[model samples]
Target chain A: MKEIRWHGRGGQGGFTAARLLGMAASLSPGYYVQAFPSFGPERRGAPVLGFTRIDTKPIHDHSKVYSCDYVVVLDESLLAVVDVFEGLKADGIMLINSARGGEAFTASGRQVYTIDATGIALAVLGQPVTSTPMFGAFVGATGLVDLPAALTAVDMTLPADSRAKNREVVEWAYNELRRKINA
Target chain B: MSNEAWEGRRAFISANDAVSYAVRLCRPEVIAAYPITPQTSVVEKLSEFIAGGGMDCQFINVESEHSAMAAVMGAAMMGCRTFTASSSQGLMYMCEMLHYVSGSRFPVVMMNANRTLAAPWNIYGDHRDSLAMRDAGWLQVYVENAQEALDTVLQAYRVAEDAAVRTPAMVCLDGFVLTHTYEIVNIPGQREVDAFLPPYAPGENVLDLANPRSLCISVAPEWQTEFRCQQQAAMEAAKGAIARADGDFAAAFGRRWGGMVEEYRCEDADYVLLGMGSVMGTTRLVVDKLRAEGLKAGLMKIRFFRPFPREEIAALGRRVKGIGVIDRDVSFGNAGALYTEAKAALYSAGGASPHTVNFIAGLSGRDITKEHIETMYRKVMNAAAGGAEREIQFAGLRWEEW
Candidate 1:
């Protein structure tokens, strides 16, 4: 079983990204996926958390993700305000959507990887909805799901007109992360 | 109910959306609802379905939850399959009509998004609202996930409209936990649902103009007792009806939640954790973790709050060395409601009393963590080893002065 937590402010599509990942993972045979938000009375721009869990067996745990294998931060600004790496496992990875290069933070031996997901989103989608691009980075960093599977998930989740651009951003972010990893 | 093979389409949706889809499949003739937090999405989706021509039903936009229940009651009395949904404050507002609906024997199927009651005014998931109405004479069933929420709604109508047990039913899912969580759910086909639950036939309770008879009228003291006794008898008969509905639904749709209570690895365990609603999912995970550590821990999910599953619970209490009852709601001055009821049931059955503890957790949407459940199991194990100090412990309370 693999659990991933997404940290983003409200209206930044954190829940949408988690749901897309779940929907994409569910397409694979023998995979059980769950996506949910830590719901509270949070208005726009307030910090929020969304969670996704994928497993070979049927997922039964409904509790919040206290210790997750990966953490995806949609906004790097939240790093100063929120403890985005609170419950990340020692061997887990943190994928942050930032334009900065070589910005690093490690907690309890956890690794932090920064990517220009917002830049990719603005270039591809003409906006800063970093969820899709960050999803691409997640796929690239974790390799838990395939690029085609993630694109198919975007196709199913987003509207028709938005799918093409979202797919472009996803591919761009994925290739960018792969290039960075190799470098 | 036919045993014919029927296939269902699988989709990823939230529990609230699942309820809307199930109501559409059931094809309720009248749907009267008032929007409330965590429950608004259900009627919103249903209204969308109605607007998109996906379902042909009367959608009544009532002013309040009380009016919503009254509208459904009126429609049900006029021989229409009626449905509605509500949450904490709304349900409490509709409390009077809930009793009236059950007493009039109008098998109205309602979905309640379980939320915490107010003094501090919380809009989070808890069982206080629905459990407060346990004596209102409605068949209440708490579901653990989106699939169970969908499947239970289909079975609720079957159980509610049973000729022998003409009573109302409340299908409850935790407000945000299950209602907002997205899951992959297999929705049964309309043909299968129709086969399983034929159109509700309002027998002897309808408002017939051809044969005029007073309904819900004032009864003398002597006849009032009989009326109450008959309602009690019908409630008792509903136990069998609920079991039959589950069995028939399983044969038709390939999913069954063991009638009133679902036991998970409880047969050979020295300690059992009992709970209801979505928290049972967490309890199961805790049980598995404990079992991995060689502790004989198990979980029992009480699906049906009404009818209380006395026999099953009593038998479980006798078998397990100790039982921990996790209640999201309190009974005030005694213990959690489930803990109190389980103790009463065990005592009445005159059996060996297993050391029982009540763990009140998740009040007002407080997240019950894995650590809290681990502590609960450790305490249960301690009690089983004859080291119990308290009868009730609040799982996540912050003691400022202690």
Candidate 2:
């Protein structure tokens, strides 16, 4: 089983990204997925968590994710208040959405890939909804799911008017992060 | 019963929305509800489906949960199938109508998102809301996943509306745990669900102008006992109706929710953990881990709490050395409702009454983890093997009042 915990403020669509990942994984008959948000009363700017678990068999454990394979940060400013790496496994990766161009490092031979999904979102969608770009970056950097499947999930989730640009940003993030990972 | 070639499609959705889709397939005539947290999305989705031309049902906008129940009951009495949903405070607000709906044998089905009653003002999930209404004479079924939540609504209507059992049914989903969680579910085709569940035949119970009947009328003291006895007989009859509904539903749809009580690998096990709702899912996974480690651990999922499944509980009590009852709600001064019921079921049985323990866990939406379940199973196994026993063990506590 692969578990990913998403961190963001309430209006940032972190749970939407988590749900999209699950939807993408569920496109294949071999995978079972669970996507859920921390069910706290959502206030506009309050910090919240969302989770996605993907496995070959049905996922049954319903408790909050204490240990996770990946920690995806939707807002880089949240790092100052929240421990983004708290429950991350030793070999797990931390993917962040930052436009400040943070240094990418291999820590203790584990991958810590950083992508400027905010920059990609602003460049492509003209809004800072970084969920789709980060979704694409996670897929591209880790190869967790196929790009086509992830793009299909985006198409299925977003409306027709918004689909084209979101798809473009996802592709841009996927390519940009793939280049960085290969480099 | 349209049986032309049909197939169920798979979709990823929340239990809340899943109920809406199931309602569309069942084609309930009326839906009246007041939104509450964790449960708000269900009616929200249903409204969307209605406005989007997906369903052609009468949507009653009500002022309060009390009126919501009253509206559905009135519609149901007029021979139209109906649905309403509430949770926690909202459920408690409709307390007066809960009895009126069931006592009249309206067969009105409601999906309750099980949540905690307020103390310090919490909106999280727990079973206190629905379990508090246990004696209100409604059939209750707790679902473990989104698929079951959807499928059980279809089955709950079938069983509740059956001629032998004219009872209202509450299909419960754990508030945030099951309700808000998104899962991939196989949505039975509309024609298929229609085939499994025929249209609501109001029969003699409904209010018809041709043969008018009085309902919700006060009975005299001498006649009330017979009314209570008839309610008990109807509940007893519900046991068979529930099983047949599930079995017949399995023949139509591909899934069977194990009639009343679903046993997970309990035949050869020495000890068993029994619970309802979403915690049982975690227990099932933990049971797998225990079995892998050569521990003879198993789980019994009590699906319907109203019918009680006394026969199955007694038969299992005769075989297992111990049975642990996991309850998400406590009856204040007494044990959790499920533990008390399990003990009562075992006390009168003729065969061996296994040693028992009550685990009062997951109160006010506290996370019931894999470790908590494993520890409970170990306690059950240990107690059965002549170890120390605690009558009511509250799992995952930082410190205990006792």
Top DockQ: which candidate number? Answer: 2
Instruction: State the lDDT of candidate 1 residue by residue for B31-84, as single tens digits.
Output: 999999889999999898888777789999989999999999999988999999
All models: lDDT?
Answer: 0.88, 0.88
Give the poorly placed runs of model 2, Cα more than 4 Å off.
Answer: A100-109, B1-7, B400-402
Which 10 residues in a row give candidate 2 chain B its minimum summed lDDT?
B1-10
TM-score of 1: 0.96
CAPRI class of candidate 2: high
* Share of reference contacts kept by candidate 1: 0.73
Error of 1 at B124 (Å): 1.2
- The alpha-carbon lDDT assigned to residue A39 of candidate 2 equals 88
